[model samples]
Target: MDTLELQAKAKELRQEIIKMITAAGSGHPGGSLSAADILTVLYFDKMNLRPEEPDWTGRDYFVLSKGHAAPAQYAALALRGYFPVEELNGLRKLHSRLQGHPVSSKVPGIDVSTGSLGQGVSVACGLAKGLKIDKLPNHVYTMLGDGECQEGQVWEALMFAAHYQLDNLTVIIDHNRLQIDGQVEKVMNIEPLDKKLDAFGFNVLLVNGHDIEAIQNAIDKAKTCQGRPTAIIANTIKGRGVSFMENQAGWHGTAPKPEEAEQALQELA
Candidate 1:
């Protein structure tokens, strides 16, 4: 897709995310909105995915480590034809496949069930290792929140990925600088993150998470990297598209009111 088309798709996805969250009444809008651009670029532009065959072995895999932002992934998957776009409205409903967090067994496009912050990276590493063992050339992409890094298991996974020289594994950090509590620095500082990942033997790239061109370039560079896993530190806002929610920690886990949702949608429009 061209840059213009991708950006247009991203805008539509962001709007869909707002609609889904608004209908659900309780979902993580801030993080979802923040990561929309990245997810759009991945599913629509960067990754080679087959919606008809969700378990297609030759396709690239994506694991949203910050699974609270499943709405973002759902928007991308729906746009890519993984499931009916109308199912988005059923988000967080009881017995709905579109749960607050993605469940791989229930959701056709989900590669792994992820909601427990730090575990997704480990799962991604396992997928990468399994592919390596099977001599598969498919790449694994995982995205984690800056706050999720507080979990020590993430670092352990990082070490394992680097040690194994999992060049096909790419990790993206949604460095939005805010979590449910407050600022990431105040909650559990993981700054100097690039330096730390580099020291851990990763080919680290820092870029604006919302920039389509930059994200595509980073993904391309990651694929060619040798001897280590690549980490893209995506500096982003907490609630990127909506005016009231941007950089506001209060919206981290809170759903917007009806009026707020309407305004949010209008802003995106």
Candidate 2:
């Protein structure tokens, strides 16, 4: 897909995220909105996937390490034709496959089920290593929240990935700077993030998280980055594309009321 199409799709996904949280009366919309462009580029352009054959062995794997952003991934899946878009309305419903956090078995396209802060990156490392052991050329991608980086497990996984020289693995950090508590740096400083990641043996690349073309290009480079894992630090606004929500920590986990959702949709429109 071209940049224009990806941009349009990202807007739609942002609106859909608002709808999902509103319908469910609860969710993490800030991160979901922030992650729309990254997921759009992954599903619409970069990843080799089969929407119909969700379990195809040859497909590249994606793990949403920041699982609170599942709404964004769900929107990408539904829009990419992995499932009916109407299913989005069922999000967080008692029996719906679209729960507050993604369930890999319930969702056809979800490879790694994650809601815990740092576990999914480790899972991605394992998946990448396993694929390499089996001589598969496919890659594994994982997205982590900047706040999620505070977890000790994340650093451990990075260290392990580097030790094994897992070049097929790519980690993208949603550096939106806001967490559920407050500002990430104020909550816990992880500054000089690039240097920290590099020390962990990752080939780090920084990009505008909202730039779909840049994201696609970063993935291309990650695919060819040999002997080390890649980390794309994506700088973004916390509640991107929504007028009242952008960079607001209050929206980090609050579902909008219907009127608020309407306003958000109008702004996104």
Strongest candidate by lDDT: 2
Model 2, 1-269: lDDT tens digits are: 68999999999899889998899999999999999999999999989999999999999999999999999999999999999999999999999999888898889999888998999999999999999899899989999999999999999999999999999999999999999889999999999899999888999999999988889899999999999999999999999998899999999999999999999999999
Q: Which stretches of candidate 2 lie over 4 Å from their true place?
A: none
Q: How much lDDT does each candidate structure score?
A: 0.93, 0.94
Q: For residues 7-46, what per-residue lDDT tens digits would candidate 1 score against the true structure?
A: 9998999899889988999899889888988998899988
Q: After aligning candidate 1 to the native by TM-score, how far in Å is the CA of 57 from where it should be?
A: 1.1
Residue 77 CA displacement from its true place in model 1, Å: 0.6
State candidate 2's TM-score. Answer: 0.99
Candidate 1 residue-wise lDDT at 11: 92
